[model samples]
Target: MAGPGQRGVGEPPRLLKIVMAGESCVGKTSIVRSYTDPHGAPTSSSYLTTIGIDFKVKPVMFDDIRVKLQIWDTAGQERFHTLSTSYFRGAQGFVLVYDITNLDSFQGITSWMKDIHEKAGDEVDIILLGNKCDKESERVVPKQKGEKLAWEHGIPFFETSAKDNVNIEDAFSVLTKEILEKKSCVLYDFDVVALNESKKRTCCAF
Candidate 1:
C-alpha cells in the first residue's frame, strides 16, 4: 500500500550520491550546512575541520520525482587527499566548489576535477560552484572563466553565496535535475538487462 505521497511498490525513489570537493577553506562545509538548514542562523566561523568525510541526507521534490540526495563533504587539504578518495568511489554527482574571492582556490579547481575523474570516472555528473559570490570587493576569479571551464568539462557552473543565500537553492536544484536526467539511464532494472546482453555478446565472441 502506498503512503499519502509515496510512490507505488517496486518503484525506487530517485537517489543521488553527491560529493563536495575543493581546496582548504574554500567554503564547502558552509554551502552544505546552508542548504541543509536554511532557516538556521549563520555560524560565526567554521569550527571543526572535516577530518575524512561527513554525510548528510536531504529529500527534495523535483517536479514529480522525489530525490534523496546523499551529500558527502570531504576534507580539502592535501593531508586529507588519501582519506578523501575513498569517499568518491560510488558518487553519482559532484559539486566542485571554489571561492570566488580566493584566486588560489579557484586555480586549484582543475586538480579537484582530476581527482574526481580519477576516482568517480568521467561518467559521473559534476557542477562547478563559485562560492562567496557576495564578496564582490574580494572577487578574484572572473565569472566568465568559470563558465568557460564548466563548458570545457561539459558541466554546469553556478555562482553562489552560501552566506547570503544567493543562488544556493538554484545551484543544488540544477545538480539534482542533471543527475536525475543523465544518470537515470542506468538506475533501474533495465540497465541490468542491457548489461547482461552486452556480457552475452562479449562471451559469444570469445
Candidate 2:
C-alpha cells in the first residue's frame, strides 16, 4: 500500500553520491551546508576546518521521482589526501570549488583535477564553482577565468556565494540532472539488448 504522497512498495528513491573537493578555505563546506540547510545559520567568520570527511544526505524531487543525494565534504589539507581520495571511488558527480578571492586556490585546481581523474575516472560528471563571489573587493580570480577553465574542461561553471545563498541550489541541481541522465542511458541500453535477445528467440520458435 502507498501512503499519501509517498512512493509505493518496491519504489525506493534513487541514491546518488557526490563529493566536494578543492584547496583549503575554498568554501566547499559552506556550499554543502547551504544546500542541505538553506535556512540553518549565517556564515561565520571563524569556521573550523573539516578534519577528514563529513557527509550529509538530502532528498529532492525531480520529475515526480525522489532522489537522495549523499554528499561528502572532504578535507582540503594535504595530510588528509589519503583518506579523502578513498571516498571518490563511487561518486556519481563532484563539485570542484575554488575561492574567487584567492588566486592560489584557483591555481591549485590542476592538482584537484588530477586527483579526480586518478580516483573517480574521467567519465564522472563535474561542476566548477567559484565561491566567495560576494567579496568583490577581494576578488582575484575573475569570472572569465573560471568560465574559460570550465569551457576548456567541458564542464558547467557557476559563481556562487554560500554566505549570500547564490546559485548553490543551481549547482547541485545541474549535477543531479547529469547523473540521472547517465543512469537513464545505461538502463536504456540494457533494455535494448534484452529486446534484441527476445526477438532472436521468437524467430527461432517460428
Which candidate number would show the highest TM-score if scored against the true structure? 2
Each model's lDDT comes to 0.82, 0.86
lDDT measured at residue 198 in model 1 versus the true structure, 0 to 100: 97
lDDT computed for candidate 1: 0.82
**Could you tell me the lDDT of residue 74 within candidate 2?**
97
Error of 2 at 154 (Å): 0.4
Quote the lDDT for 204 in model 1: 100
Q: Which parts of model 1 are misplaced by more than 4 Å?
A: 1-12, 44-47, 183-206
Q: What is the C-alpha RMSD of each candidate to the true structure, in Å?
A: 6.8, 8.5
Q: For residues 4-96, what per-residue lDDT tens digits would candidate 1 score against the true structure?
A: 233433454566789999987878888888898878938516446678889888877766566678899999999899898779988888999
